[model samples]
Target: MTTPTLPENGEHLLARATAILAKGSQIEIRNLVRSLYPAEAAFVLEALEPEPRASLWRLIPPGVMGEVLIELNVEVATALLAITDRKDLMAATEQMGADGMVDLLHVLPEPLLSQVMESIGVHNRNRFEQALSYREHTAGGLMSQDVLTIRADVTLDVVSRYLRLRGRVPAGTDSLIVVDRKDSFQGVLAISQLLTHDPHTKVSELMDTKSPGISYKTPSRDVAALFERRKLLSVPVLADDGKVLGRITIDDILDVIREEADHSLMSMAGLTEEHDMFAPVVASAKRRALWLGVNLLTAFLAAWVIDLFEDTIQQIVVLAVLMPIVASMGGIAGSQTLTLVVRGLALGQISGGNARGLLFKEISVGLLNGLIWAVVVAAVAGVWFHNPHIGILLGAAMLINLVCAAFSGVAIPVLLQKIGVDPALAGGVLLTTVTDVVGFMTFLGLATLFLL
Candidate 1:
């Protein structure tokens, strides 16, 4: 096939491909899509609506199908997999790396997954089963079995000859793993050292023993942090007995980091990173309805609290006007603290030892901010409503609510984390509820006591 002219910008390529797809020109779409790299092709597919996405997916060449599937979001990949022929699926997955295959298997239904597993060669089947043994969010699951390892006793000359015989190394082979006779964890030999050191130097003389191997059971988030902190190109995953399981490369860690960031951002809004942007209306609505229902319940709780002070609201009409100010201010303040605590928790920065200190710090910050904004709001309310008493009450309510907001912000995440709930997923909703209820109750309760 002749090379087609490529678009300079990704967006331009997507737009052009989309326009071509709109015209239902199959051959042109196929040529345009097949010309792009697998990742670029996946991008185009993801950018299209469901029907068009399916059309574009059908145009992708079989040779690069596996790579494109690897790049697509889980939801989109799973959808495509459901429609693909079993033979085609087997062909696409035949050459996939162990890590990629494991990822694919995760989204496949058990029956189809069994069929695909049965189709692979014995060696590959063993490798896939080993990788599948670990949890998907663990180091073993994130690692690839395609690692180059060297014996510690081998000299640089021997290493060079071996590399020459092998002809190529893995894609991210910045270093060669050095293992003992029993295939146990030892260390790594940097490629630079092999290239520059004396040919007579033994692998043990140059291997880095200080850099640690990650346990296969380590969480993927912790693995990503390790990679980031060490500036690692690759690290070995090892069993409890120090047997090398596999090696996680920078590319895999990058995927983990990205997935994590997406998870955090989406979880804040009660959504998943895997949520397809172009999902069908009913399906999307059904998924969203759960969170909306959760929010509605929280809204009702706040309304119930307001109902308790209904007489106060009726007697003091200004309380109704100034009430939102109290709740809104507290909500914003609590969110600021909540976001920080959740992030700190995710990074492993916040712990039991420092949590108390952090809590006090946040409370102090809330107090200072409450004093500042409270005075400002109090003065404005006094002048606007011509009542210093109402102004004083609003300011007191503001100060109390802000302080309560800060406390809840820190406490909510820590408590949720302890109870095995994801702080990022549940913390915001809980924090919002706390601030709203506290703000409403404090403002309205004070009104009921004094104004009534």
Candidate 2:
């Protein structure tokens, strides 16, 4: 087949694919998609809704199905797999890397999982099971059993000849793993060194021994951080006894980083990163309703706080006019601090060592900002309503609420994390609640004491 001109990016590819699909020309659509890479095709599939996605999925050849399926999101992949026949699913998964297969298995039904396991043969089945043994978001689960290991005693010439005999190395193969006779990992022999160094040099002599191995149980987040900090191409996952289980490549690390970003963004809204953007209306609503209900409850709590000063609101109509400003400013301020703390926690930047320092820093920031904005808002309110007393009361309230907001923003995430709750999912609601209640109470309470 002649080479096809590739689209510039995913969006352009998607647009062209949509145009082809819109024409109802299956052959043209298939031809156009066949030329795209698995990852690109996966992106297209993700962008398309279910019905069109199914039609496109059928056009992809079986040879690339495993790769394409692996690239799609777990929910989307499972949906497609549900429609596929047992034989086809087996065929598609048979060629997948250990980590990819493990990922696919996590979403598969038990019966189908069994059948898939039966087809993978004994050696691969053990590897798959070993990988599955780890939590899905751990280093072992993210690693592939497919590795090229060489004995440390071997010379570069011997290692080079062995690789030649094997015909091809694995993708992302930057180094040959060096291990002892017992299969315990020793070090890594760089591919560059293998190609450039004296062929007679011993693997042990040339290998990089200082590079650390990731424990099989290390969290996937930590794994991604390691790859980033070390600028690693791949790292070995090791058993407690130092035996090598498999390897995690830079590709896997990239996936972890992307998922983390998605997770952080989604969790702020009390949603998971895996949520399908175009899921059925009822299903989507049902999932969202839970968070909505939580937010509603918090809203009621804030309303109750406002209700406590209901007469105050009535006594001063101006207070009713200006209540939202205090609450809104506090909410925005608290959200900023909360987001920073959450991000710091996620990156392992904040800990016991610096927690007190950070808390002091955030509160100090809040005090400074609160003073500045309180003066601004107070000036605006005093001038607008021609009431200096009201302006002074509002200013004090703003300063008080902002300081409270800063404290809550710093404290909430740390407390939630300590209690094993995800701060990202819960922090915003709590911070908003605190800010609103405190902002309203402080402003109105001051009004009650002075204006009443």
Candidate 3:
């Protein structure tokens, strides 16, 4: 008997699911969903609009729903959770990891959360509560309580025998964590060593003591960095007194990396990482309206700057024609610097010791570029307007605006971070305001003084 193969890519899966959904066959939909990985199923669900999404959701197996829910975007997950029965939700989550359950509880309604809490086993409930106590964006929240550990004094034979009795360990358990009698983390014993070594060897002799346990309070972003730099498959989370709390797997780190990437991309447009593409129209509009309003205010401020130089513009119509070029060039130059600084901040590459060096380097680049482009623009303006004075004014204005833009580009993000504002969200608006005002004031001010 031959079975069918599912497409590996999400787009193909979405297409197949959509086709099946259009046919409105419950059996076909259930078969399609049941065959997919939780993440693939989640992709198909998110790709559908609300009505079809609900239809597909009902077709997913109850055991896999918790996992699929974990894979979904926050808004989508929240929406799905709202319609699910509390007892059914608890049943779905019974086999879920403690960390995943904690995340779900946060988005669940108060009544649903209470019902689920009452239904879960006492040990699982305690772990969930512990995970929930920590900030969501920290190591503690991301760590799973289902850690497999061994005493440092145990022999490899004892470890192997104990593992055989337990049946199976959690996924991503590349090494067994070594702990002292007090449960303080000692080191790790690799599974390869456990399988290959002479059974008589003491666990303490073969354990890698150099591996460090991550502090529970560490930010999730920093934790992701550690995983990246160290190439860790799994790392132990430690309490303040050095007791082991849980383990953070590579899977959890992947989620953190995805979230940070999403955040950086969205924040530039003043949007949240969890923003749902298929969110209701009014809700989406409300979120975007605030950002648009902020941009409008900046636009008005730039216009006001130009209004002050209206007399110069009216007299020499060429000045008005050439004005936008200056502002546009300045804005582009500033945005390049701003993007670099924001990324540096996100990667922890920018620090107090090196920030001044980066600023100096950016300003120097601006000066060099401004000088080179200034001559080209000046020559173009002179040839086009048939006025050498207009050329000189345009050149000087370009140089001033570009230099200011470069300075603002580097300075704005740094200033925003110090004041606890997200540079990605606020930096573009502020940078545009600076470039427009300076570009207009410098170009038109020069023309007013010399050409007028």
Q: Residue 410 of model 3: what lDDT?
A: 88
The weakest ten consecutive residues by lDDT in model 3 span 82-91
CA lDDT of 386 in candidate 2? 100
Regions more than 4 Å wrong, model 3: 1-7
* Residue 275 local lDDT, model 3: 74
Tens digits of per-residue lDDT, candidate 3, 1-452, equal 89996456877778888899899888888789878898888888788899998878876777888888888888998888877766667678787766667767777777777888888789877867777898889998888888888998889999999999999998888999999999999999999998798999999999999997999999999998888888899999999999999999999889899889889899989999787789999999999999999999999999999999887788888888899999999999999999999999888889899999999999999999999999999999999889989988888888988889889998999999999999998999999999999999999988888776
lDDT against the true structure, per candidate, is 0.88, 0.88, 0.88
> Would you list the clashing residue pairs of candidate 3?
none
Query: Per-residue lDDT tens digits of candidate 1, residues 65-165?
Result: 88888788888888888777777777878777666677777777789889988998898888788778888899977888888888999899999999999
The digit string of per-residue lDDT tens for model 2 on 299-415 reads 999899889998888878889899999999999999999999999989888899899999999999999999999899889999999999999899899999888999999999999
Candidate 3 C-alpha error for residue 44, in Å: 1.9
lDDT of 3 at 80: 86
lDDT value, residue 266 of candidate 2: 93
